[model samples]
Target: MKLEDASSGSLGPVIEVIQSILNQTGYILPALVLFIIALAIKYPNRLPGTTDPKHRPGVYFPPGADPLIGHTRMIVGFGSEGQFENFKALSDATPAGSWNVSFLGTSSMTFVNRPEYLEYIQKTNFDNFPKGSQFTGRLGDLLGVTGIFVADGHPWKTQRKQASHMFSNREFNTWVRAVIHNELDDISALLDNVTAKNGPGKLILPELMFRYTLSSFAKMAFAANLNCLSPDPDSLKRPVPFAVAFDRAQAIINDRFITPGWYIWEKFNKTGRDMRSSIKTIREFGLDIIHKRLAERQDEKKDPLAPVEGTKKEQLKKEGKDLLDFFMDLTTDPEELLIVVLNFIIAGRDTTAQSLSWLFYELMAHPEHVPKIRKEIAEKFGEPEGGVRLDYESFRELPYTVACLHEAIRLHPAVPKNGKAVMKDDVIIPQGPNPDNLPPVRVFAGERVGWSDWVMARTPAIWGADCEEYNPSRFLETDEAGKLHLRNFGQWKSHYFNAGPRLCLGMNLATYEATAFIAAVLPRFNFEWATAAQGQKSAWPPQYANSVTHPIKDPYLVNVTRVKA
Candidate 1:
């Protein structure tokens, strides 16, 4: 029996109640499972794994933890940003070979960050790792098992193929670049206001970068704009649909580490306690569009850009059959498109924004790099003759700027720590004998095999000892004569885009969004960190597991002073 059936056995009426919920929601399996798990958790004597491990060794936990909460106190008390420090400390403290990460109960969930081992897990024996219940189950209600983020085997394969063909086209890039240019004056205005106040400055809030990227994503993906001009005003315009919901979903996912806690009890209420309004907003927005679009498929034959049978002029004119349009074209299931778009929006906005924000922070932290970046920007098209945005080809040509951006991604991957589960009991990563009293350390069918966020990026094996350094030079090649080469610095050891078949589909889209936003912002002004911001540090773990990695903890309050030179 699945956890949903097994856990919710006594809530006999729950089957129908949950089915009704499943009907109302987009992610059927996950919603049903959430409710079922919620119902089941009320009685935990029946919980699994109470019995001691077959091999009784002293303790599977790490060294310095308090016997009671173990890492929970640090994780929960600290929040997401704090956990980054904790991980850094633990990583630095632990020597490579075999190390243990302490969880709630006994066995310390082992974390190995060496390169050769990292390669095995992420590639050589890739399928052995997949999204386990620890991560996916909690998000199931929100994501469902339908999309690429959750789908296994063929479903995932199809999701990849479809996205590659439709969303990755140059046409989408054209649309995105045009949207960014269309909004160029608006973004420049913000930079101008800031620069006048503080000489040269940048907005440290990843939210700004997020909005820029999201606006671009909105234009391309949904053909709508979040209207993210002024923060508070734009926020009120549509309420943040994607941000908080994703955060809450991720927080709940992270709560699993504490165990015997909130996850299973979240469903019995009118709405799952874990459900954030933003998740609903995002779903509603996407589904409403899907329904209206599907309801008028007849017009698709008439005019690709003309009004539908009954919609208004502006609506009628938006007849472009993008993937989202294709999604409407393909599935009647409510959760399907919403879930797909949910992941897509999350993928596009958060990651790109975070990357850009941190890149700026790095630039501000090292004012020297700004000249190099500015020179790269200037060399391409000379100076942007007054208040103008650099076009697409111009944006792509700036190699050093792209290098800085990739370097930021390497240091601070937005989607840090992706979880994957093994479909079978296999040696996914290289297997060495457990010291003793360990659970054989095999990559099982349903477990969070590893946290890939920083491991691969910082692997010495991948980028040498400089893996931990914030050098953009790694991404920019220098010829034997010391001349700078602009070769594509595409893949790094870090799975920031999550290597293998399950790589992020929005990679190119995000690149375009970041480049466009940067081209618009870089030359306009300089930046400085807020007193409390610049690399503030993670306050996580105690906060949530499934959170996006970004620079809020270290966000700078920049002055976007207009350039006089």
Candidate 2:
């Protein structure tokens, strides 16, 4: 046969076979897609590990959620600024304050916004719910894999046991108070310089608060001065490398919570690169601090009494060393030491600073409360004469001042949301009598449970009718003697520093630091929103920056006028 004819004869059958297969696939493709859709619709809850709708009859699943992604779009849609709006809406939609939804198809999250459920999860059945891989996987790089924040079970227990000393030690706490005072001197100097240079309100209080707390924490934890709260005009304008990197890393880490397949994209994306660079800066700074301490420790070992001890104060200082000293005694591993110290930095720096920013913002917005706080401060310290100095004992006397702090935290919790993974199939029984009449919801192993203190802070059932209002009075009571006392709202209701075993290690220190600033500063200087006071109302509920902690968003400027003695 001719070459062309021979080729055509051989190719014809193969081409026909190919054509037949393509034609069949054309019909089969649509049928397969339709079948998958129908299957999804029919058995939306039929996945191997999802909670069946029938099983969670009491829970509200927000409508318009994709069968696969569930309410993930609601989470990932908004930037950090509006991140919690959807959660607020969801909380409002379900009066009972419990909801179940999936994130990446198979992974499920059960939210318990009620305070009682929080008590059950955090205290009653604490062990069943660990922080889980979902949380550790995202935050591990920045927070450290074995850090106190990420550790569970025995490691957590051991870390907690050792770390508790800083909070509980009388002498150490006194040192922390002294450190806060020293840092405040820098803040005061900055405020004076800024107001003099640019007039009142040149200072952004949140930024200043972060700087103040970073400096305080560095001293209190590491005994190394970062000088983060420098008064220099140029320094005020420029970001501190360690502080900037720490905050940036946390903000980036917050993104991973909502970004689907974040791991895959983060490996190749600018955001991921930025996060790594930030973390590297943090790690290097941490290691540098660790190495210096190790060197000093070795020297101390060489000559036990080389550093001469002075007075009672010096003895106490030596007896109650900083957090780094405490951890250095426990382990010499630089990485481990860095992890624990960084975890406390989050507690010392971010939580206290953000809490104070929110507290002061509310105080500035509602100046009516400022007088009450000042009045309480004066009552406790006897008129701020010669500038009142607060010791550890003094903090206990300012119940009203502490109440105001608690109230502000209730409205704007630093750590707004937290969760734990369910170890096995279990049911959550609402605490109290279940006023909302919510039924028990069953959770399977591998699923996670979460609580939004931010939403709970606004829930009427939890905080009463004036939940949205910035009312510190809700956390207080008037005695027959006409004295204001803070009512114990318990850990679950307050829920800012958390509750039970995982309760924030630095809660006492945080309270002391923030209240000291408020007591000392508020008594001496008036903090007013410079622009907002000029007839423009600040946002009714202050907006927050999306970070590991909920910080007041920008435009945090405040005028600091010295209160007449």
Candidate 3:
């Protein structure tokens, strides 16, 4: 009887524990199974110990990528400062000049740094790879449906054709030149005033360059003077509304690139709200310009042969029209006009401004080149009594100046990387230092591919050991007669302005503007870093804002002194 009582006491607690576990298992089992199934569905190839045999055998990835999340943890961990560093690390690890990275599960991004891959994607398989919907959708709010930067297929082709005509027009080019000259004159005046107020004062060159480019484009495209660089008391107090809206819109749009499932985030978060507000501001600003331009056009039509009212309108003739007038003739849709004008303004403003800023940065960093450029400019254009006379013809004559611009662009490309979406299954055969002798990489449909011009321009294998150095003479060659001439590297090998059918349409205009602006300014001012500015060291390889155009990360400040005649 004693033994039976002892057994019962032990058995009672054991039975109770068994029953409790059984009851919990019923609920827990289903959730566990569901979680496993979700992982299987999302990352079938990513399960621990299971490798994807389908990927190019030599393709590499960062170590310790989670099966469920892939490289997301590492990428997110890097934050902003280390984002490009992560890419550089991957490139260094691989011998194929490419690497595969996954954000979550099987969703992957293949980064290609090979020149051959760039050619294949941009030219050989142009139709197969496109600026896919994801890219266009992300930029849609800012660029609109018709803007060439975000457009694809038919729309892109149509806009490119029309824009080409506008860009190539003699009258339009003349008007652009006039606008550039006027803006430069204003910049000179502003600098003079600053010098008078605070002798040898520090000037933020990037900000000044932005104002110059923005004001030039505003006058050329919108027939409105932003007076962005003006020292006028009225202009100083009130900022240009369009300029502010444009910058805000650009920042918001660029943020979408890093925002995962951006479409979803845009729909359900503060980012969406901010983007909407910026879009609204941009739309309203554009509409105001369009309305004003339409009224002006109507007035001109109502009274043909009447003398044009403003200095800007003088460029408009009954036979030849500026871009705004041309687009207004094509479609009265205010939104469409806004899209076209904004596209031009964004392209013309950012790229040129960033390019000039970097050019000056390089010049200040290497002052020895300044005298060479100035001497070249003087020899070609001749120093006038007042200042340099910069026209289209004279702009092209400065071979050394052009080479310097090219070198600067190479070191600091305005657009550092270009991306495309694989529309169909494609194979890329990478060239240059295929150390592992890797086979072609098969990119499945819907996969993303990116190429870094910045990387290619700096790679030792591609451009030789001194690729990182800012040597303007690299673009120049001496003839048998010992006279130096510009070597035409062309767009394909350079890739600075991109390549193939979709090459930047504003290349000529941008080149002309940069040349003119530099010519006008370099002859008059001696530029160097301010003592305080010098103390602020820019990060090597130069940090960049994650914008469509990767502008310099920090403000570049310099002191400008007028050159004595």
Backbone collisions counted per model = 35, 0, 0
Instruction: Estimate the TM-score of every prediction.
Output: 0.74, 0.88, 0.88
Q: Residue by residue across 284-398, what tens digits does model 3's lDDT show?
A: 7667767877777788788765544443555534334567866776788888888888888887789888998888888877889889988988887788644675885565677
Off by over 4 Å in 2: 1-49, 78-81, 197-201, 304-319, 382-386, 532-541
Q: lDDT of model 2 at residue 428?
A: 87
TM-score of 2: 0.88
Q: Model 2, 349: alpha-carbon shift in Å? A: 1.4
Better of 1 and 2 by TM-score: 2
Q: How close is candidate 1 to the true structure, as a TM-score?
A: 0.74
Candidate with more favorable, higher lDDT: 2 or 3: 2
Candidate 2 local lDDT, 283-327, one digit each (tens): 888788778777767877886544422212223345456787778
Q: In order, what is each prediction's RMSD in angstroms?
A: 11.5, 5.3, 4.7
Model 3 lowest lDDT segment of ten: 44-53
